[model samples]
Target: MSPARVMVVDDHPVVRDGVALLLRNEPALVVVGSAESGRAALERAAALRPDLVLLDLRLPDMLAPEVVSGLRAAVPAARVVVFTAHGDHHGVQAALDAGAHGALLKDAAVTDLVAALRRVLRGERVCDPRMVRDEDASRSAVARSGLTRREYEVLRLAAQGRTNPEIAETTGLARNTVKTYLQSALHKLGARNRVEAIGKASEAGLL
Candidate 1:
């Protein structure tokens, strides 16, 4: 059989290059294309029609959920396997809701990542087994915060090292709108900035 055609989508050039390099040695997997953002990913998918897409959650032009949607629409034959730094949370749920086949945390060993890709290509649903569990649920912090669902989403992404423009691209909001939401979230959490807000959210089990 021909090798399984695969595409990678990530905003980070090093990540894209690394994944490509790793797959280059796999006898059954071929790197059909790679893109640096959601729109570019869609555009390339339209042409390459790869068998799988290793999708990143924080893209420069779109969120993981939206990227999943666009990839499915653009290439129905291609399955999406979310390759992200984020652990299981509302963001992962949203990606699943958007029709992703599987998810793998970025910290997984390269061998494990490769194995998960093969499993997902075989039509199995897989996610990070060592998922981050909610260790604490201090409702008091949340009660004191009064942050909305959107605010939680925004904060969660911010906690994952996403910049404001990246958050806007991922969340499909204007850059200014994302900044405003971030400010509001910070205020609600009594956080002086994004880092503090993220810490508060983690303590509240909102991450």
Candidate 2:
């Protein structure tokens, strides 16, 4: 059987090279390409037609969902698996919802990473055990907070110090809509203000 053709997509040069080198040592996997951003990944995927894509959750120009959607659209046959440092439910859930086949943490052992990739190739949906546990634990918190996905998204941006206008622009929502979401988040979190809301959300693992 032919080795699985894999493409590594990460913005960090060292990580991209290191992952490629590691994969090259595996007899069943071949490192066919690498990209530093989501756009580059999409462009390369169209040409390389890799059997699998090892995608990072956060890129310089796009988030996991947009990148996953683009990659799937660019190469329908390629299986995409998210490799990220972030284990948060929102990010992982977004990637999965966008059609990622698996999610693995950056701190995972190389053997585990390789095994997960192989499982994905064999048609299994894999998520890191730690992430699963965290997700499970936080599920109730998320429900209790009554924080919708969009509300979490807006709050996350606010936590990053993005102003309402900036959040509106980034989310493509009207300024009034952005304010509404923030207000709703604050109310749901029982927060007195944006700062309080961010703090509460972070503590609840919503951010």
Candidate 3:
């Protein structure tokens, strides 16, 4: 069987090149292409048709979820595995919800990265063990806080620096409704303002 054709998508030149070089050294994988941004990744995915994409969670042009969505739309057969330095549960969850096949931290061992990729190729969904622990802790905290899913969603958007109007547009809710949700979240979180609410929510992993 032929080696898996992989594409590395990252904004940092050193990281992108390094990952590609490492994957190239593996007999089971081949570096087919690399892109610096979400847009470029989509373009290259369309043209190169890589079997898997090693994607960064944060890119200059777009976030992980948006990029994952685009890649799925552009190449439905290609598997996406987020390779991010951040352990941000919200971002990772969003990308996974958008249909990414797996996620791994940049600090993971080279062997772990290769093994995760191979597992994904075999149709397994893998997430870093550390990330899974973090996610579980976050969910427990959120549960303890008793934040409703909508409230959590609104607060999460606020944490991302989105304005009320922007959150409304994204959630298909009226501005007034968004404000009401935010206020309720603030009250529950015992936060005096949006910034404080965001901080508190983040600490509690409600964001």
Best by lDDT: 3
Model 3 C-alpha lDDT per residue in residues 29-95, reported as the tens digit of each score: 9998899998899888999898999999878766666678788989999999999897765678767
lDDT of 1 by residue, 1-207 (tens): 898999999888898888888877888899988999988998889889899999987676555666787788788988998888867454565567578998888778778888998998999988887654443433344455698767767876676556788889999999998888889999888889766676566555564
* TM-score per candidate, chains pooled: 0.66, 0.68, 0.70
- After superposition, the stretches of candidate 1 with alpha carbons farther than 4 Å from their true spots are 132-207
Whole-model alpha-carbon lDDT for candidate 1: 0.78
Over 4 Å off, model 2: 133-207
Q: State which candidate, 2 or 3, has the greater lDDT.
A: 3
The segments of candidate 3 whose C-alpha lies over 4 angstroms from its true place after superposition are 133-148, 151-207
Tens digits of per-residue lDDT, candidate 2, 80-198, equal: 99998977656676578668999999888879989999999999999998775466655677777888888877876775456899889989999999999999999988999986776
lDDT of model 1 at residue 204?
Answer: 57
lDDT per model vs. reference: 0.78, 0.83, 0.84
Clashes of each: 2, 0, 0
lDDT of 1 at 65: 67
Q: Which RMSD values do the candidates have, in order?
A: 7.3, 6.8, 5.4
